[model samples]
Target chain A: MTREQEAAVINAVLDGDVNAYEYLVKAYEKNVYNLALRMVGNSEDAYDMSQEAFIKAYNSLHSFRGDSKFSVWLYRIVSNVCLDYLRARNRKATVSLSVENDDGEDVELDIADEASSPQALLDRSLTRDAVRRGLQALPPDHREILLLREIQGLSYEEIADTLDLEVGTVKSRIFRARKKLCAFLIKDGNIPDYVSSSKLRGGDLS
Target chain B: MNMCEYYQELISRMLDDELNNQERKVLAEHLSVCEECAAVYSAFSMLSDTVANDLVEPPEELAEDIMAHIRRAEMRKRNQREQRAKRAASRQIRNIVAAAACVAVLVAAVGGVSVVRNLRRSNAVYESRKIESSSGTTAQGGLVDATVLAPTPVPTAAPAPSSAPVSQYTAPAAESNDNGGLGSIIRSWWGGDDGWFSSPAPTPVPTYSVPQITPPGYGSTVTPEPYAPQVAQSEAAPIVVIPDTPVVTETPVVTEAPVVAETPVVTETPVVTETPVVTETPVVTETPVVTETPVVTETPVVTEAPVVTETPVVTENPVVTETPVVTETPVVTETPVVTETPVVTETPVVTETPVEPQLSMAQPDTFSDAFIPENSFAPEGMAGTPGMDMSFSALPDFEEAPADFAAVSAVSYDFSEQDCTEFVNAIFGLEEETADDAQSVQTDAAAAEANSGAEQYLSYIDKLIATEQLVPVTLPEELLPDRTESLTFSHEGFKFSLDIRFYGEQMCVLGCDGQGQQLCFMSDMSAEEYDTFVKDCLLLNEVE
Candidate 1:
């Protein structure tokens, strides 16, 4: 929904037209549910979290300042509910994808040369399954920001606003999260590394 | 790897379209040179696309479930509001009824005052008239005696000629002669006969004189002359002669003597008794009227007492009922204030004041460690150790104490029974008489504690007991002697040690929970109890 239309619907809900809330719910439910799924890594917990987020958003609808996009605000609630759920269950990240190299700088993941082109990778269902598995393996904080930026299609500033972080932190966290996902995919052998020797020589020259 | 790391972060930002043109140009230059950066860029871009397309549809019933819950919550809120309004309305009605009862009592009191005032006025009037009638009777008797003595000389002068008949006649004549002698003499003198001087004329003449004169005198005389003659005739034959003469003289006197004798009879008896009788009869009749009025007034006055008594009784009943109801509400409301502010405020001050020394002495690891050397204290400490253990085990059972106390209080207004049974059972486990005595002490202590602002703490302790948060531990009687003391076992595995000491008239029970929160319970103490408790504490200190 557009910003003005979303605000109008919110006002109607606040004015006691409870049915007006269904419009906002219907518009955002898919994105909210997918974000919750990526964060929680299970359909059942994701569904419950999404419903809780919507209810919390409706209950505190009057506190919405309209300064941010309605979806960004809704995603913030979804993110919080998911984080609280993960924290309550004490779910630790299973795989640590980002590792400090010998030079004390974060190294970008080396994707295979065969998966170099976006169009070629897009055609493969195996790459999509590998990406989903990789997203689930990332820590909750990194996964949350990545979901907001990529799946929810929020801008870096909007992701920062949703997760209550600085834009710089959002950029770095997203980069780290992407590097982790790529490393997981490469380790899983989803991408064939046909040109790794040539890339390593080029990296040493740089 | 370092140069590639910088460009890759730009690549991550660029996938989100967050790069400025200059940074994008730098990132594009680096990506063209670095093959690893290009692959990373392509993979990051492809991953973003795949995640963006990954959508999970929510269950269709989610909105319906949420709305159903909201609707139920709204309904619950509305019901609570309605119940609150109903309670407020009922409270208003009770207030109006109490106000109306007060007005009714005021009206009854005013009415009773007026009735009493009317009775006093009527009583005053009756008393004044009685005094006047009594004095009037004595004055009339004096006049009758004067008239009787005045005629005696005339009879004595004629005594020689009729001495034989005079002896017989004088006895009968003497009585009536006392009343009629003056009337007959004056009448005879006026009629030219000297009948009163001729006392020996016959006993019949004196008797006849009495009836004739006495009728006119009936009103003035204290004694009713007509009633006197009837009484005398029944008693004596000489009085019979008076009736015979009246019959004999009736025909003759009706024509001539009535004119001659009645004028003299009227003139003489009125002169002698008519004035007095006229005054006396009306006075008598007035006194009767007054007496009759008093009788009438007295009956209503007697009725007024019951009316006054009954109204006061009715007034007193409502007042009595209203006082407790009004008093109890204040006590209930004040209890919270007492508990929250005053009790909390005073507890520390009382503990710090006189009990500072005892607190320092008792601050050892265990009470028994500090107190074991004293002769009287060892048994109590040893006894109390097992008692404390029993108290912990028995703590759960005393949870029903508060509910029982509430039920008992609801059934009876007499606090002694409920307080004694609950407190004794819950805390002391003392005998019934000891419980009774302890309850009385507690009542006095409660009243004194209320004055000193420690009542709130006691009542708060009471509330805690009621809620089963605080468990009452019975202490040995020798520990505080004449003072009631109990240790409250802590909740949630908090270790607490209790210290009892007196500060002024207040008995302070101080303890610290495992979390370091200070819990102080205060009760009032009489001066004598304070002295005794102080002496015992000092004895223990000296022995130590």
Candidate 2:
């Protein structure tokens, strides 16, 4: 739905029909859950955190005031929920944030699964594991920033709003996050030499 | 190292597409010189690319799970509100009984001393009781007041009614008190609506539970008229102020989150300093680059070739130079009077002045004497007798050669002011009964022919120039015409020549080919026919 439609739905929710809020939750649930899962590093905790964020957003719907996009506001709530959970538990750095299949087993999430036969899965599992380990190796703040920049593909302004930081801070932090992740991958020999060599000159950094 | 640090920030901004063009240019130039920065940027870029390709999708049931939680929370809130309302009702009933007992005791204690006075004033107490019952009618007014004053109490259950008459009488006051306290806390939290609860209730306080009704159409268009009667009832009493605390204290958790969260936020240092340094240099440089190119192109055109001055006619027709010299060279060399003329005197650049008569006088004494035939047979169009001294100075009158003749032209000559009317009419058997009639006929024919024929000739010239088949050959010094009107054109292996001149009163036409072969068509039926045939040689540049 467009922002105007979201605003109309929010107004209906505030006027006491609380069911109208399900539209907003349904619209942003995937992005919010993905953001939470990346931040908290586990399916169970990510699920709990996403629920809490949506509940909190619904209760506070009256205070929204329509100053920014609904997605930006919703992402802010998701980020805060994840941050609070992370801060409360003081979670260890070496936690893997991955998706789980219907059977509650941790599985790699591949959008194009036609080639995911056993042989292809076996070949890709190595690289996927290396990348996940490299992500887990960074500080939580750096990992979160990198996830927002690369995985979410958010603009600097949206990232700033979600993290409650200046746009410049978001830029510099994204840079620092990438550089640190690169160092981690390099130290583990996860990345090939061509990545750090002249062959990578045409790549996009931001 | 400091420069590297600054450029690192700039490079980061560049990757974000945050850098303006000038800053981007400066950073690019810096990167070219600094291999260390270049390597760092590349590594960052590679890392970003690798991470972007590895995306982690959320579980499919996440949205359903979130929605389930929200619906469960809404249900729990509603159940809690209903339970709270039940509890409030029971508590209100007990409080009402206790208040009635106290009122009875107070009346009994003062009963005897004021009995005689009370009996006299019993009518007044009954009247006041009637007013107290009016306050009881204000239940709906109280709820509207609470809703308008403090909206945070929206989902909570409404206050229950008291059973005793006195407690019911004070119920509206108690509701307003609840709103005042809750409104105060909300005011403190939002820093708005402070005066709403600050003033005491000037209107009569409604002392009963207000009815809760959703407006028609699922409460889509809620009008304020439902509370209109409540406002009227509240105006009956003015001194009731009940201090309620439960809802006011509970509101802080809902409204104060932002207040608690805003203070500890890390202050953002000035990060926008680099933008001004990006500057207008990019725009400034861009404008000058566009403007300088045209100036550069025009300088070469003016300084290089003045002979090719006029763009199309003079430059494309360089052949005019070699060909027109045929007439001008001889004119300058043969006549002492005309020798003073400029070399570029063709066309209108040299005045056609009264030099015509002087040039004509000079021409007959010299060149014309060779071309005139003595005792020439009378031409078919001539009215004069045959052999009558047909030389330039001694030609006979030919009756104005009536204007009914066709115009003719030959190769290598500018056919200026010459109408070979009588010659063309006599040769073509055009009977001229009257000058006006014949002239009109001839004029119409010439116009039609010139339109089609001139267009064909212009296109033929265009084809010759395009193919580069027409070479310009200079006339031999002795062969140049004395009059600049004569022109020569050459093609293949042949040069064709035409000279249109006046000898005394007679007009003469001369044609020559490259082999020194000459034909002079002065006046005869055959000569007129030959003149027509020779013009074809001008187009093909061939003599057969």
**Most accurate candidate by TM-score:** 1
lDDT of each: 0.38, 0.34
lDDT of 2 by residue, B1-544 (tens): 2687578778767766778999999989998998767877776566566666655556677667767777787789899999999899989998997896576556544543343332222111111111000011111121111111111111111111111221111111111111111111111000111110011121112122111112210001001111112222212221100001111111121111111111110000000000000011122113222111110111011100111122122222222211122112122122222111111111111111111111111111112112121111111000000000000011111111111110111012212122233323342344564234435433553464623222222233223234433222222211212221122222111121123333233333332111111223343334434445444332333211
lDDT, candidate 1, B157-185, per-residue tens: 11121112111111011111211111111
Candidate 1 residue-wise lDDT at B4:
85
Off by over 4 Å in 1: A92-125, A192-206, B96-544
Worst 10-residue lDDT window for candidate 1 chain A reads: A197-206
What's each prediction's TM-score?
0.41, 0.35
Badly placed stretches (over 4 Å) of model 2 are A90-129, A198-206, B2-8, B29-42, B92-544
Model 1: per-residue Cα lDDT at residue A113: 37
Per candidate, native contacts kept equal 0.52, 0.48
RMSD of 2: 58.1
